[model samples]
Target: MTTAKNDINKRIQELTKALETKSARLNDISNTVIDETGKGHMVISTEAHADYQKTLGEAREIKSLIEEQKAHLDIERFPRRAERAQLCGPGRRPDRARQAVQVPV
Candidate 1:
């Protein structure tokens, strides 16, 4: 069983890895597309189309990974804060917000 903080950290690491891979793939796709487009006449229709499709696929996969990581982080944090907020309802209760005091005099 993973503690909430540990789970959050693990998810953060996963997200970072995913982001790095996504960035590299995106850059590669962008370079390919731009290079092909720049050479208008020499660029074959099939090659350009293939690069566009690859870029789209990479983007979609990255989006999915990000959403998955976000869900994990949300799930980890939600219980502690969200559950308390729900139980407490809206508006802060002054008693709960402040510590008790004692008069020495």
Candidate 2:
């Protein structure tokens, strides 16, 4: 579990860094001036805009992947009640863990 969690974290970090780089590049492209037809007209980088869109899509995918990893971790951390009882409820018998505890009443 720890290994899997660490792997997921590492992937998330890499994806985040890649996304940041793409965003910065997109911003730079957006700021660039492509062609100056006249004082009233100017064109920015079309290729940059396209790259930005692609990057944005990739970022969204990364975000979703991160969320999925987190959800999986949570599920692992907190299992079903019966499963828990089976693991630590009774004397050595895990199958009998779900049985109700006896009382004097």
Candidate 3:
């Protein structure tokens, strides 16, 4: 379990780095290119937006892996969840004195 968690953490780190690099590239692309009109005009970089979107998708996949890893860690910490639940289950009712009807004294 620890090994799997470590592997997933490593993958998350790699994906984060890749996403940051792509985001930086997009920023660079946005600033590149001056218009010939010499007027203050703004143009959108469709390719850069597409690249950012792809990176976002990869980041979401990484986020899912991270959530899975967290669940794995929780299970590792609570290894006997099933046994604990059985010991203190909601289905089992406790014996109550009020339930036992007493006869006339």
| Among all candidates shown, the one with the greatest lDDT | 2
Name the runs in model 3 displaced over 4 angstroms. Answer: 1-42, 80-105
Count clashes in each candidate, considering only residues at least 3 apart in sequence or on different chains.
0, 0, 0
Cα-based lDDT at residue 50, candidate 1: 80
lDDT by residue for model 2 (29-69), tens: 66775558767586756776677677678767777776787
The number of residue pairs in model 1 that clash at the backbone is 0
Candidate 1 stretches greater than 4 Å from native: 1-5, 34-52, 86-89, 93-96, 99-105
User: lDDT score of model 3?
Assistant: 0.61
> lDDT-based ranking, best first?
2, 1, 3
Q: Put down candidate 3 lDDT per residue, 14-67, tens digits, no spaces.
A: 756765675566567666545746697655467756766676676567666656
Q: Provide TM-scores for the models.
A: 0.51, 0.51, 0.43
Candidate 2 structure, TM-score to reference: 0.51
Q: Give the distance in Å from residue 81's predicted Cα in candidate 1 to where it truly belongs.
A: 1.5
- The superposed Cα distance between candidate 3 and the true structure at residue 41, in angstroms, equals 7.9
